[model samples]
Target: MRRKSVVDTLREIRLLSELDDGEIAVVEKNCRWKTYGASEQIIDQHSDSNDIFFVVSGRVRVVNYSLLGREITFDDLEPGGHFGELAAIDGLPRSASVMALEEARIASLPSDQFQRMILSHPKIALKLMKHLAYLVRTSTLRIMDLSTLGANNRVHADLLSLARKVTKDDMTAVIQPIPVHSDVASRVSTTRETVARVMSDLARKGIVERQKDALVVKDLERLEDMVEDVRGE
Candidate 1:
């Protein structure tokens, strides 16, 4: 077993807020570390998996590759995320392909050991179940947005999704810009130029303020107005 630092491993497990020191040791003792370069495939969808992974740093995109072999990214995993739990727990094939978006470090636990740990520690299983449920609900909402909303409204809903994650205050949500317009377009289901034009318009309207790393929501009410209009149409 290639052991990683326990302290460093714990830092990536913020999603497991209910797990305390004693429980954490069980987790750290089981982990192995690996590094991946940008664009590396971590796991192929439908492939057998005997390892569970926790992101130590950098980003991974969870995507679906269709029969036609096109990749559709559903979510991006940044720091403080854990995946591969589902396949480990259920002994099933991977549900999605994971690809590193940047150079990343990850902690891995053997699937057999993970299953044993979960049975021994009810809290671990409970916390993991809650986390998985939240992902399902969030994904359903994203699919709902794409189905019913206009591109503008989908953008608004997605921004709100980001807002809800940023802070409880809701007034100061940070939506970062993509250096590439095509990236933004994929998220909002619009053209690259359309996302650029609409984002510029929102900035001019004073509903969004651009800062170094984010587009801050200065006025959520004004932003929701755009969503409401889409629902009306």
Candidate 2:
């Protein structure tokens, strides 16, 4: 595979989308790029490195371990997504550890450069604020689900959220690279066994089917209704 040039990789980053070619050239000069193998640690939770990172290719998961060493996943970021800005903004340690879910290419801008960019670029600043707002909102929802919903319903919400991200049609959706039950369990704070059972039940009900490389949601409406019924929506 051809290694992407600095400009090419910068072009793939959503956070830098608003930059003009000249602006990107400036950024290109200031940023550092690296690639990691699958499962490689990109950033350690509570570490002091404050460079903001952007995904140029592949995927990464933001996560933290509980006191008992149980992993709690915060989110996954694919190509075009960015992370680590919170640390840059607040001048604090990383809030979560980040690991590459697959072999991934990433770009990093030093905290000082990132802060300067935000101060100089109003659009970038606005985008950052909006993205942070979204993070807070989703975190609130997750907290609510954990506090009020049962394990099964939390699983439902997790699947529903995933399904919405890659909906195929009005009646169907396909989650490519079918989710790992253990990962779902971690995300929803349920046991792996519970996630397996819930998924098996979903399969038996014909609401979801496992394909060669994906999980197909056969009855998207029905699944939505199931989630809504519990949420009283």
lDDT of each: 0.74, 0.90
- In terms of lDDT, model 2 sits at 0.90
lDDT of 1 by residue, 1-233 (tens): 65553336665476455668777777877788788899998888867866889898889988776686545566788888888887888888888888899988888899998888778778778888888899899777677777887776666666656655664565566665523456555565567677677778778988877788777888876666677677652
Segments of candidate 1 deviating more than 4 angstroms: 1-8, 15-26, 66-71, 163-180, 188-191, 209-216, 228-233
Give per-residue CA lDDT, model 2, range 88-155, as digits (tens).
89998789999999998888999999999989999999989999999999999888888888999999
Residue 217 miss distance in model 2 (angstroms): 1.7
TM-score of every model versus the real structure: 0.77, 0.93
